[model samples]
Target: MADVRSMCAIGKHGQLGLNGKLPWEGTRAREFREDVQRFFEMTKGHVLLCGPRTRRSIPQFAYADRTIFEIRSSMPPAETIAMFPNRVIYIGGGPPVWSAYASFIRHWDITRLPYDGEADRFFDPAWLCGVRNGN
Candidate 1:
């Protein structure tokens, strides 16, 4: 079986999003771009699993060198994971999708942004600690 991983940027307070977009307007757009490029480089030639909303949020050009599995709310994570054995699958998205696949994920790549902002969505700190503790 492949190793399932999750990646995302979060605020100090665990905020992931605000009003359907990233909460922070990065002072340096290039740095943000570099971060995104690095993410692609790290996950290069691997499959990425994301929900519809996250998929739509991404620009069309961003999919150039990667394969993406669009996971619907109704899909079973185990079934999806089973479909990609011996591969590295990166899960990128919001809380619900994270919760759905939390049990199967073996690693997490969370980027902690420098500042905090108002947010409507958050990544649970407890979940991060649990994953780190191998719960």
Candidate 2:
């Protein structure tokens, strides 16, 4: 079986996003660019699982060569993972996706940037508790 992983870049305040875009979008920070590069590098050739909102945010050809599955409310997270047993699956989204699939992620890569910004969305540390106990 392949591994399920999560890669996220947050701000000093645990800010993940604001207004559907990255909180540090206009900050001209090297960390954000590096993080984005790392994400693309790591997720290359891997399956991506994201919710509808995340799917819509991505450009039409952004991940055209790779498999990007739109997670549906009717499908159980476990069942979705099972569909791609031989390939690494990366959970790509914000809090909602993380909260729903926390127990299935085998590894979590979180990068904290030096940005102090306003963000309506944040990454909750408590989400990892399910990963610790469930698997």
Residue-by-residue lDDT tens digits, candidate 2, 7-96: 888889898888888788766667778887777788878898988877776666658566888997678888889999889998987677
Q: Name model 1 segments beyond 4 Å from true.
A: 25-31, 129-135
lDDT of 1: 0.75
Candidate achieving the largest TM-score: 2
Clashing pairs in 2: none
Give per-residue CA lDDT, model 1, range 18-110, as digits (tens).
Answer: 767677744476656666667778777788898877777766766887778799877888898889888889887767777777767778888
